[model samples]
Target: MLRRTAPCTQAPTTGTVLAGSLWHEAADPVTRRPGGPYGPLREPDVNGVALPEGFTSRIVARTGRRIGGVLWHPAPDGGACFPDGDGWIYVSNSEAPLLGGASAIRFGPGGAVVDAYRVLSGTNLNRAGGRTPWNSWLSCEEILRGRVFECDPYGSRAAMPRLAMGRFRHEAVSCDPDRGVVYLTEDEPDGCFYRFRPAYWGDLTSGVLEVLCATSDRGPVTWRRVPDPGGARAATRDQVGDAKHFSGGRGCHYADGLCLFATGGDDRVWAYDAERERLEVAYDAGAPPAAAEAVTPSGDLYVTRDGGDMEIDLITPDRVVTPVLRISGHPGSEITGPALSPGGDRLYFSSKRGPRGDASGTDGVTYEVTGPFRR
Candidate 1:
């Protein structure tokens, strides 16, 4: 494989793609192998996964297939959907397919790269992430020792030690288009809810990161500062950089209007309706079970958990979390990375069926699950 290294600086100006836009087209100019606008999927019945009796799945694109200049590695965890011309684009959060793999890199099947800044290196454990109104991916490192990274439409990447997001085991993130703020969650035995207010709005390094503390009045709790839990307490933080700066915030998003979407160790989905200054359990997926991902689209709210009875949980607009998809894998292979197509017509998730160590083509797959998302 031809490997390249570039500085992680400068104003990322990827020619064709916009920092605040979406990517949805085929990578190569030749035959246009569309990335996809997938809906609920069905396993192949024989050796593949089976969808619900009535729903169906067709492979729009999968990992390990060569789309353009890059042969994508099997998706281990984390992904994002961007607009790429007439079609939609998909980027995986994976290590390089080869031995010394790179992280936070992407291919162009969904869109074309007209600029010189393509391919990124050295970001790790990138689990679930949210698309920014600015059209970038806020990729988080799941390893108790990881950094909250920012990937631009132009392909330039940077790591932010902005201690505001809390320094715990980070799982996922979601954005608020109107407020221009990002909500975060932590993944640990006991974690917390957090919010990162970009003091400079779009600027990465400069921002105020905060955590949520549920109020007893059943009203909106105040933002608690994530402390420098040093020594043993700092385990989640030191692995990446500073322990005092980061906190263990996990899965979250803007589910209903300004109401914050949150879930994690508590197995609980809470909606912190900021406008109303009240906190409510939109749904309790359950506690002990880790709620890794959740998002509020037009129809319902969806979340995935990594626990004994691993299953993807779904909550209706009325606040109901039902077990939708059961994942089949151990620790590293646990299911994660749930992203939506630009139109919100489809859903995507990543599973690493491969062993804990192996990185490339380990029989892992990036799944396309479309709707009518039914049982």
Candidate 2:
């Protein structure tokens, strides 16, 4: 099992870490034996999905369904959970080819969608993104020449672009609240791992964008700044002279003082220790990974499979990868987003093209699986 590092001296006031620390509880491999923390999954009682023995899944929202006077956005991708009054707010990204953006769904008691609406609009190919320490969503546009937009989860505010975060085919982001730094992943075959240090901590309007350059897999690394944050004329990698190239960067999550990121082309997960200035491989699945992933409060990593017997694989602190949930019927669809609730009892994700691989974006569905997860 990975050893625990010293906690950040500066306390975080926003994001998932503040919602509830996933590091407080340690996962017991024995308990995760036959099934996992919850138990062996049983055939879904409702949505045709499956989960660990005591878990239950419900369709929270579906594509083409009109809610809050708008069609529930399709191609649901990366998402994050934020604290609400007594429940929580789930902000989901819609990676539609056109008219792509983000949507918000408020869950009250008993995991019910009290309200849902479009939080971001007028963007092209909104893909995977992460939540900020300030309680906002960084909606990424996956186009070759795209930018990151900060959207309000409440849908009351307009989406703003943070050009300083760099213009690239962004896939995911993970924020280090205490240090006030944000890690971003590019989705290109030879993409680079980047970190944005805002001029003023917690402010994304201006920052220095730097790419990682490590001599070894485990490293005492260095960073090289991107000549241009707005990749209008050239990509960030082309501008950064010494940027280290990664393979098809995808999902990223921050937990236990480490920034964990995945690369689909490499089928590997990597961990970066910002404080220690080190990088290490966490897991190599030997196959292309799903577009989204989530880490439990207890430090377990869950990655969805891109194809071929779709399943959500669990990686323990000891780096043991096991298939926990097998997604049935979604032949050509990829499991896009996998997000855990603030309380750590619920898991939320979406099937990109829905069960039958519908190309019209009308068959996508967002689901919530509630169960006894390690807190």
Candidate 3:
């Protein structure tokens, strides 16, 4: 079993802590043995998927295929569902190096595709990102000295690159509306966790980027402002010597005063109590590979598998772990972007390499799994 309790050793305080004296409840590991709830998965359906009996999946879009008039971009990743009036919009990122950008599919009230369009272009290697409280999508670039593009999910406004958010191999981000800060994760072996304190609450045009620093793994942490966020003088990760290194930081999600992030290098999900200024390991073993994560209305977390048999596992608020769905014959592909619809009845994700398992992900397939999800 992973260590549930670690003495939090406080590091020497330097500068003003952004979180100040605010503190919240200590975090507990959400990992638990499987088969605790939801029972076992049924046999594969017609779509070659195994679900919890009541759920069904359908292919919503395919690579090099037309949804409306636009061709669905290949290698779809990092998606978020936004409420669009009576319907909702699902925005997904394109992980193509040269043709990197983002696209969106608008769904009607009855969960039918109303339209499809591209919202961002001229970017590179668009990876995982997060949705803001204001309904905008933060499309991140996974490249050297990359950037975060704030995109409009409705595809009405133009996407803007948030240059002040620091330059690194960004994987995903999460917005803490209460603190007016946007947390970011880098995708390197020795990457550092970061947060952007915007000049204004909702504006990303300018901000003070800070890196997390601590003396121990599960200890009190401090936020140190990065001297140069642009990486013109030195790389953002090397700017601060004492910044905590998170091996291959991948997914990040902020909810209920806790920021949960996954580090793929170690296959661990860590929870940070921003208010309490403490960190804890949420899931270390006997859990999913811990790639991208999406939280449901009932507080259950859906984590996509980074490798192996393609599947998405659900971690309930009470700590039971179970498989939500599994995709067969896609061994070379990993699941990406497990996002819930605004109504919370449908889940959206993608098989990054499709059935053929191409390295370029040119034959990716986007899927929709509908079921009696908790509201």
The most accurate candidate by TM-score is 3
Query: Candidate 2: lDDT of 163?
Result: 89
lDDT by residue for model 2 (69-174), tens = 5678878877777777778778888888878999988888677778888888889888788777677888999988688999988777899999899988988887
Better of 1 and 3 by TM-score: 3
10 residues in a row with least lDDT, candidate 3: 3-12
Q: Which one is best on lDDT? A: 3
- Per-residue CA lDDT of model 3 for 1-375, tens digit only, reads 010100001100111021211213224445445544565678888877888867889999999999975899989988877778888888889998979899999999998999999999989999988777777888999999999999998888999999999889999888877688989999999999999999998899998999999988787999999999999989999999999998888877766566778888887777888777788776776544646455544555566775675877765666666777889988888788667776667888889888898988888999989987654
Residue 276's C-alpha lDDT in candidate 3?
79
**Clash totals, every prediction:** 37, 4, 1
lDDT of 1 by residue, 92-126 (tens): 56533222122322323442332222233465555
- TM-score, each model? 0.65, 0.88, 0.91
- Error (Å) of candidate 3 at residue 364 is 0.6
In angstroms, the error of model 3 at 326 is: 0.5
Better of 1 and 2 by lDDT: 2
Model 2 weakest lDDT span, ten residues long: 1-10
Better structure of 2 and 3 per TM-score: 3
lDDT of all the models against the reference? 0.46, 0.72, 0.77
Give candidate 3's whole-model lDDT: 0.77
Return the candidate ranking by TM-score, descending.
3, 2, 1
